[model samples]
Target: MDTLKQQMEYAHNITLENCRVAKPIRFTETSSAYGGGAEGLSDGFAAGFLWLDKLGLAAKYQVTHLFRQSFFGGRYALVDMQLNPNPDLFLSVLYKRLVEGPVFQVTSIDIPAQLRLYAHCVRNAYYRTSWSTEVVRFGGDKQTLAIMHLFHYRVSY
Candidate 1:
């Protein structure tokens, strides 16, 4: 579901210093002619996860699976899924179990109500950035069962 990506991005795109909204639904900015900011952009994706983990916010959902489907430009990405908010301790352990420490691929977990989501990167690794997440209920359970799509993208400068 696109909303998963959008929600992740919304929780991620906040300015840590001021807590301001930093991402839009799409990118429309012009980049440097030669493109130098690609490194931070790349690391940001993975860093987003680690940041969320550090804050104990990443565990809100199941993240039943994650997969890397398409890679264009200089990036490769994986889509992750979660049934709903579980807990931060679980998220931290689960992420470490699936992504790091052991490494779990998206194809490894299969469940219904499943759809794909993606993260395009421009960096070499996730250890070099500062980003995080915060999850909350979608007003109520009604919102989750009713809405199937939500989208968010960031235009980096």
Candidate 2:
């Protein structure tokens, strides 16, 4: 996880220094070969993507594959060859539904390394209200906690 963080920071710095106009970094392909099968793959994917979103470093990122053949022997794909959704697919959906643009900085004092929290604007159809979403991950567990707060404002005509 630290390595992932370092790599992002390095990339962000390099882009800032080298580019004439700022361009958001995009991860064309990223995958984890960790040994815990689909569950492990989901954990890695969520961690990396959420960290990127938290830092506002990525404009876009694509996972390695949507489907992998049985003979491929890698859990990187979002689905099996038969089109069955993997845990990563569900995570990706939830992220898309919950997180929107304008990332917010989250600060903590001596928080445990295992706990991560990211805040973003909630995706809403209505333009008159405000919403906040928090994405939290605890350790390497398969569970992700998402907390969303909605604030409504009335317009006076």
Give me the overall lDDT of model 1.
0.30
lDDT of 2 by residue, 42-86 (tens): 434554454333333332221212222222335555565566765
lDDT of 2: 0.49
Candidate 1 residue pairs in backbone clash: 3-150, 42-122, 42-123, 59-91, 60-85, 60-86, 63-81, 63-82, 66-106, 98-104
Write the residue-wise lDDT of candidate 1 on 130-153 in tens digits.
222222221222322221223243
Q: What are the TM-scores, per candidate, against the unseen true structure? A: 0.20, 0.60
> How many angstroms is residue 129 displaced in model 1 relative to the true structure, after the best TM-score fit?
28
Give lDDT per model, in order.
0.30, 0.49
- Judging by lDDT against the true structure, name the best candidate: 2
